[model samples]
Target: MHKPQGYPDVSAYLIVPDAAAVLDFCAAAFNADRLRVIARDGGGILHAECRIGDSVVMMGEMPDGPDAHLHLYLADAEAAFDRAVAAGAEIVQPMQSQDDGDLRGGVRDTSGTTWWIARQEEA
Candidate 1:
């Protein structure tokens, strides 16, 4: 009906070269749960959704796509960053405390999407 449960009003939609790999990376890197995958008749994923934290990220397969940059706030940003690297994501920035009261880092997944992970200090 009106937006799915546990999904934010504004969600990020990503189109990548390999939707399946991105889905798997999201699961491993962010502990996201794969929710749905609608496949094309010929082949490849036409659409997919994953629940990362309280947000639902929609994705589809598009070769050499326009890359996306997503920022995520997590309880343990370091662990998530480690998991992302272990899952084949290239580290673009190291985790470090920021003046804005957040520990942040970044990584680029194989699908060309860059993820900025942070653990925000409680105000």
Candidate 2:
């Protein structure tokens, strides 16, 4: 089957309580770009798409419970970790340089989604 234009082979669909806030946080913390957003008449988001680097993440407000966590990759793990913290995310793990040569860390967003941010260390 042919894939849609501008979409990756795999993408994450997130259902959170507050789609708008999550979108904003992604933009501020990860430099994500808002691709599209559909809002409900009742003042909540129905669906939205955001681009972080070349990957796109689809998100919407959940009708009931919380959403699942996600893992993200950044060129600079430390900077992304700090930006996420400043944007109201709490640190789940401090940045560490792994033996495999990856810098990684974890943070939980305001809506309770955990993100594992990492990058391959330079040679």
Candidate 3:
């Protein structure tokens, strides 16, 4: 087996109630770039790929399975937190400096997916 271009060895797949809205929110909050989208039979999204920085995330509308949560590392944790709040994401945990020398925060999107965002502090 060979690795695909622009994909990491492992990636996250999200199942949300609204994939399109989630994509839009990610664009506004995390500056994610849409790579591809596949529509479902009736009216929802079947699959979609989005890139946030160098990381790629795949997602789709809710299926017969459990939901997913993700922990993300950002280059600018503060800015990302503000952007996410402004984009209507509910703050699950406020940003704070950790003993490990990192800034961390958490937010829940409209679809109820929680994201833990973090960034290492400058030396």
TM accuracy, model 3: 0.90
Per-residue lDDT tens digits for candidate 1, residues 54-99, read 8999998889789799999999999999999999999999998889
Q: Estimate each model's TM-score.
A: 0.93, 0.88, 0.90
Clashes by residue pair, model 1: none
lDDT of each: 0.93, 0.87, 0.87
Off by over 4 Å in 2: 1-4
Q: lDDT tens string, model 3, 11-117?
A: 78998888898899899989999989999998899999898888888897874546568888998878999999999999999999889888999999888888888
Candidate No. with top TM-score? 1
| Candidate 1, superposed: residue stretches over 4 Å from native | none
lDDT of 3 at 99: 92
Runs off by more than 4 Å, candidate 3: 1-3, 63-65
Q: Identify the leading candidate in terms of lDDT.
A: 1
For model 2, residues 1-123, the per-residue Cα lDDT tens digits are 487688898889998888888899999899999988999888989999899999998988875646577877787778989999999999988899879778888898887778889999889
Candidates, ranked, TM-score: 1, 3, 2
